[model samples]
Target: MKKVLSMMMVLLLFVGMLAGCTSNTAPTETKEPEALKMGLVVSTLNNPFFVTLKDGAEAKAKEIGAELIVLDSQNDPAKELANVEDLVTKKVAAILINPTDSDAVGSAIKLANEAKIPVITLDRGANAGEVVTHIASDNVAGGKMAGKFIVDKLGGSGKAVELEGIAGTSAARDRGQGFNEAVNGTGIEVVAKQTADFDRTKGLSVMENILQAQPEINAVFAHNDEMALGALKAIEASGREIMVVGFDATDDAVKAVEEGKLAATVAQQPDKIGSLGVEMADKVLKGESVDSFVPVDLKLVTK
Candidate 1:
């Protein structure tokens, strides 16, 4: 009898232990790493506008308790690809790419998709392939607005120069195209069209060369505010009173307009673009459907 009781007690204890082991779940998956990781790949951090974009993105990321890794491509497509690869290796949850070249970034986007990472494009977009979302301004319309402003201000008959942004960029190409289309039949001739690479120094030098040829240049249509300011400097040095128009309405450009230096600017709300991009990324991570393209509004600012 004593042996039987002892054996029964042992069996009960063993059964209880087995039940506990079977009832417990795998420690709740260790809380799933607790934080989100994001990557931002920009064309260049050289301009103040891009810097503001970086700042806005960082602020939003921090607000949402996410880790944001930002990289600058310096307008090099090769470097931009490398940056995207590095971000993928880091296992970022999502990527926000402002590509240097729209077509050049298509492969990178495909690679990210293959890696199962979501990509949100900012400011500029990929030419082809799948992107989670593309958030930018209506650059074509902005260019048209600039063209109208130039035509009305110059009375549709003036010699203008076009300082283009980075070659192969959507912003540069679309804006140039729309502006040209707007002034196509009008007498506003684009006397000199050259690539300024969206840099102030390059803009100044290019404008200087153009000035050597056409001293009576009437207006300048820079793809961005930086080049417009640079061209303004050159015009001032040459003692020429030329109407300067620009895009991207950077703070400096706004100040210039306020001071009667610039005639007009196409204001693309970059900070809003950054914030909206982050919000969309969060929505995507939450398993929500987002728009394929988010069009931020643009304004024509003039003094």
Candidate 2:
């Protein structure tokens, strides 16, 4: 009877231990790892669009209690590579990058891949390397929207000039492709196209030059709002009644449209892109698989 009682008590203690309900110790739950670190590499913050993007990512990170390390490439590919290296050294769980140049960013993406870190490309894509996902608005559709706006407004016949974004970026390539396609069989002739490097100052100067070179300019399409506003200034100075269409309906661009100064602008949700990127990165850290491409919505904003 003594042996039997001793064995039963021992078995009860073992069961209590397994249940994690011993009298001396309450039930202990497994805590989530506190180090959910993420890294964001932005091409440049000089542009309002990218600045807004950074803000969105930061906000989301704060909401989710994740640590976000932001590095700006200043539109330099070498700097972009260095930034990725820095992130890798920090051993971040995931990386988000807005590439300055699609082809030039391949090396940086490869570095992250070697480190076994997942990468999410924002706004632009890499020409090479493995990326877990790419997030952005439908740039091609936005470009087509801008082009179609001009085509229909001009009654399908007009002369226009395109002010492109950074030459080697996916945004530039896709937008230009869609725009060109929209104008291809129509009477809308793209007499001259120029690169403004997506800079407002450069856009103003380039448009000034194009205005002089192209005698008949009925419309203009800039890849972004900064360039569009710049081109609008040039057109206003030249006193030419040219209809201007722009992408990235930023505050200034939307205001211009409302004031009847700018014809139209393609609106993209930059905030959504940034927030979604961070959410996806969090999911990746949590061992969740994300899709290869996540597209934000777009709209044509006009008066």
RMSD of each: 4.1, 5.9
Roughly what TM-score does model 1 have, to 2 decimal places?
0.88
Clashing pairs in 2: none
TM-score of each: 0.88, 0.89
Off by over 4 Å in 2: 1-33
Q: Give the Å error, residue 106, model 1.
A: 1.8
lDDT of each: 0.91, 0.94
Candidate 2, residues 1-303, lDDT tens digits: the string is: 999999999999999787775555775689888857999999999999999999999999999998999999999999999999999999999999999999999999999999999999999999999998999988888889999999999999989999999999999999998899898899999998999999999999999999999989999999999999999999999998999999988999999999999999999988888999999988887889899999999999999
Candidate 2 achieves a global lDDT of: 0.94
**Using lDDT as the measure, which candidate wins?**
2
Weakest 10 consecutive residues of candidate 1 by summed lDDT:
25-34
Candidate 1 lDDT tens digits, 127-227? 87689889999899999999999999889898999999988888899899889988999999989999998999999999989999996788899999999
